[model samples]
Target: MIVGRRWGDAVDSWVKKMQSLVGYRTFTVLTIVITGLLLFLLLINGVRPEKYDIQEFHLSTETIRSIKTVEDPVKTEEERQRAASEVSSVYQFSEEIGENRAAIVTSVIDYVLEEKAESVESLAPMEEQVSDLKENLNVLETDGEGIRFTDGALVSLLLLENESLINLRDSLTASIRDIMSKPIRSEQVANTKNEIERRIRGNLEIPESVLPTAVLIGRYSINENETLNEELTQARIEQARASIEPTRILQGQVIVQEGQIIDREVYRQLKLLGMLTNQSSMKPILGLILFISLCMWLLHMQMTKWRASKEERQRTLLVVMLILIMSVIGMKLISLVSNNFDVSIAFLFPTALAPMLVRSLINERFAVLMAFLTAAIAGIVFQEGYSVVLQMEIALYLLFGGLAGLYVIQGAEKRSHLLQTSLSVAVVNFVFMAFYLLMTQSDYGVSELLFYGIAAITSGLLSGALTIGMLPFFESAFGLISTMKLIELSNPNHPLLKKILTETPGTYHHSVMVANLADAACESIGADGLLARVGCYYHDIGKTKRPGFFIENQMSHANPHDSLPPETSRDIILSHGSDGAKLLQKHKMPKEIIDIAEQHHGTSLLKYFYYKAKEEGQSVNEEDYRYAGPKPQKKETAIISIADSVEAAVRSMKHPTAEKIQEIVHSIIKDRLHDGQFDECDLTLKELKTVERVLCETLNGIFHSRIEYPQ
Candidate 1:
């Protein structure tokens, strides 16, 4: 037993010595730097393109080839556009061309008829009428492609006199209007003119000379009336070419012959494949380093915003860095397996494991940040020179899965909760994966979908199992006091707590009241109430070693301290702080609880024993009656000290009132302040006043008067 005790002490001392050497700031900076370098190394190989320094070397394999068949997008688009532009232009027919020409021919005939009528009324000779009519119709001579009439046709018309010329004019106007009303192509103008002249000769009995001249005028007046419809024509062309398929180059095809020079086509294929080797440069490497550095810098800034203590921030960084490294390594291993077995096996990787662990064990924001970081790292670690689209999809899958895991474990408070959280995560994973597959419209067989579904489900369950198995190790290794661990320690069934309850019932009852007082007071001051409550439960555990000597456990009227010397009693009373700490240490309690036990009394004077010795004419040093302490180093421990004093002092009073409780609480705080017991802690004067008020209220409630029952 003695050897085991010494061994435990030695181990604890060694741990403390090692802990003292670790500088929080140095550890944080070093861990971040290491994490950045590791990320840069992992990602550089994937991000940096392979270059071939083929100074004189010939092609080894059939020049380079793309792993997957892909369309030459630029070439395909150009071909489609060229095909669309090849459609012929469309034209719209206009009717105004036929109408205006028919009107011009009627006007010339009307002018000739009017001149003849005037000559006849004046009783002029037929020759004079003919000459006058010819002179009046001469205006039509210069009109080409309009209403030009030849001299012979005019003379033939004058010979016909009034009736014949009028009939010819009506027939000519009707022929020109009917023929020119329909759409006329430029190439079909002659055929249309011939058809109109044929119609005039067959359907009407006009003179042949008049007929030929009328046909000439009709043909000349009828022009092509169709005009280009640009919008409609272009739309038709685009619709015709919209179904063109992209041209593609299949995988493993020869890009270039072995002995052929590296042309642009071959160079493009090699660059696309990323298979060229032996040529290295620093540009990609530097860019990768910069990217990793930026990520780490942003993570650091986020940590600063959290405002965690120096030591806590260091531990958090260390934990996150270690988890990220492990995640990256796991991804690389999984990728290797995927490369060897099935390429789809990479989807089975539980990228959420680390983030879930972080969420349960550390801060939620830290878990979320780590989720994003792990996703980025996994992208590089698992990439296999696939298309950019595929790479991005893989990264997004990991990111969503990690974030889902975090969301599941957001408010998890127990180990068993992880299993249920895992189920929720699995649901999220499957939903997201299904959405992704549908969104990308990737063709998949039933077996492929099933396989992906299984992988997604397995990721969640596996992550939860890993978190459950690993959390205890992390808690023990890092000396972390998680809420789960605190809950376990707070159980009344705990060995140390049960010992105090059974062996020192008075002290136990007193401790419970102190817990109430400390919990309320600490909460009011924004200190750790749970920690203070649990600390109070074990604060006076040393009193169990000598229950009869402490007044609280003395149920009988007789006092044990009456027979004991003041020096002896003082020694016993003062030793409880140290003794309680030792007992807690033997039970391997958390250091926080031990500190509360050891420092609650501080070095405050044992007033009763000191005054007793002084009244006896003994030259006792005042320091000799005080408990040994290193003082409270935190607000929780310091508040526990004040509550411990106030509880005991108030309980000793006969029928304590609210005003008396307030007075005693203030007195205890004042004495501690004057004695410098609070000097080592970060508790402020305002917090102390708040603590006093909370204690007064709590104590008043505990010792308040109750109504008498009717007997």
Candidate 2:
């Protein structure tokens, strides 16, 4: 409960902070988010489910396609209707129909037999006998209590012996009872009666003329025994309807062909899909605004991870914003053209190109953030429609491609190394495509594979080509010093380098040696080794201004410092740092290079000069002998300071063995540490120890493998 309360309090605090934001901070954030919204808005229009303008009977000018799969209600209803039509009606049977019909037939037979005993005592001719029996049975045919037979049938019965008449009665009665015992619907009544008559007549127990009388009597007595079951019949219809499968309209299915009339059913489908829009839709636009806001927040979090000044952060934001806008514009072009082809054009998008450009222009650390941001955008811009929240394949492939390109571009210090980035991104994209294929239970045709392959390769090549073309423009426009720029400046023929070589070759040699040492030490401590190496090359360029006054260029063994006052020599040495900074600034060198040229010495005392004046019995101030210092402000500059001091101190030793080199290296590093040369920078005591260990090892390698590095 306490933790929860604390969390709530923190959230409230954050909300308050956000509400209180003002001025430049608010402006910067607003600018980035609004710019992102405008860029991505171009993409959302194409990705949203295609809306149409039509009504129930309007004709369509173009083919209208479904952007997603949904159930087709009209087709589903037709299927259910077909299923219901096949269901037969149900009927209920009565259990007592058989006994009722049998009893009626028996009573008529008894009446006939009784009449035969009472009324017909004497024999008669056959015609008269048939006429008499027909008259007697006419009484049996009376309302609801009748057995009707023709004259031929009565004659056959009257002429039969007494035993045959009894047999006929039993047989007809049994047949009627059996036929009514099982289920029989009202529709089957006539067929049942005929079947009973056939059964009696086929037996041949009596003469053929007698057969007709038996068959007619049995046929007249049978009745309907079953009625229709309305409830059960309706239930069967429902069950059959439930068994049918619903039809679907798959994504990309054409609702109406080009130039076809928009029928009622198709219009309903379009309305159901939310495509028949008359008014403008603001939902996707609102959603895009929220999406871009979230992206800006993520970028802010990444920027916070790097501790930079407000100006630097603002600059980075604009750079990232420019790159993202370009990326979206690229995606928009691809989306527009994708409609012209059968295959998706998403694979041709150079999502990885953004990361490569950032990596080439900015430091690799910031490029990591760009990769994630680019991938997140791909998740949106490449989605199938507005309803699909994300497309995992395209998003993940972008992520993999961006990261692969970034990793490969890390070794790129020259323009030629960018080709490796193309190959790396292409390989990752292809592998991810194959992985998606194997994972999905779907098949791809040969033509589809060919299109996909071309798209992937095009994406890779585009990344490399765009990066190469954009780097020089960005560097010139932004005044940024990337590794490639730093490497270019380090070449021997550059004007500044040539000046030092021609005028002060001794200092040139010294600068090169310092470059090797600083590069090795900076790399060991995870500093910017390349920047340090390049900075070392130019740190002593000011020595060209007054060559002989500095001891390294005095080939005649003449000491200009000995002829001059201690203060004059101190002034000359101090002026070199500031003078070098001016030369670099005039040449429009990057600020980092100028900062290294200026801050490498810091404001430490020249104890030799300070003591020499005191020993000469002249009053001296320590500040006058010290270099004017705005100390080292970064890791590379700080390392260059240490490397510069140690390189000069160690080179003065007579027998520079492993132990002597360690002693002098440790002494100089400790002197710089105690004198507060590293105060302004964020280098820790532990990191300084690492620097100390690395320098000792590097110096030993330069001095012929003589010793131990600091443990």
**TM-score for each of the candidates:** 0.71, 0.70
Per-candidate Cα RMSD to the true structure, in Å, reads 6.9, 11.1
* lDDT by residue for model 2 (271-345), tens: 777786764567767777787777777777777776554544655666677788888778767766766888778
List candidate 2 stretches off by more than 4 Å: 1-31, 73-246, 279-281, 307-312, 333-352, 365-404, 419-462, 613-625, 657-660, 667-676, 705-711
Q: What is the TM-score of candidate 2?
A: 0.70
User: Which candidate wins on lDDT?
Assistant: 2
TM-score of 1: 0.71
Worst 10 residues of 1 by lDDT: 55-64
lDDT of 1: 0.76
lDDT of each: 0.76, 0.78
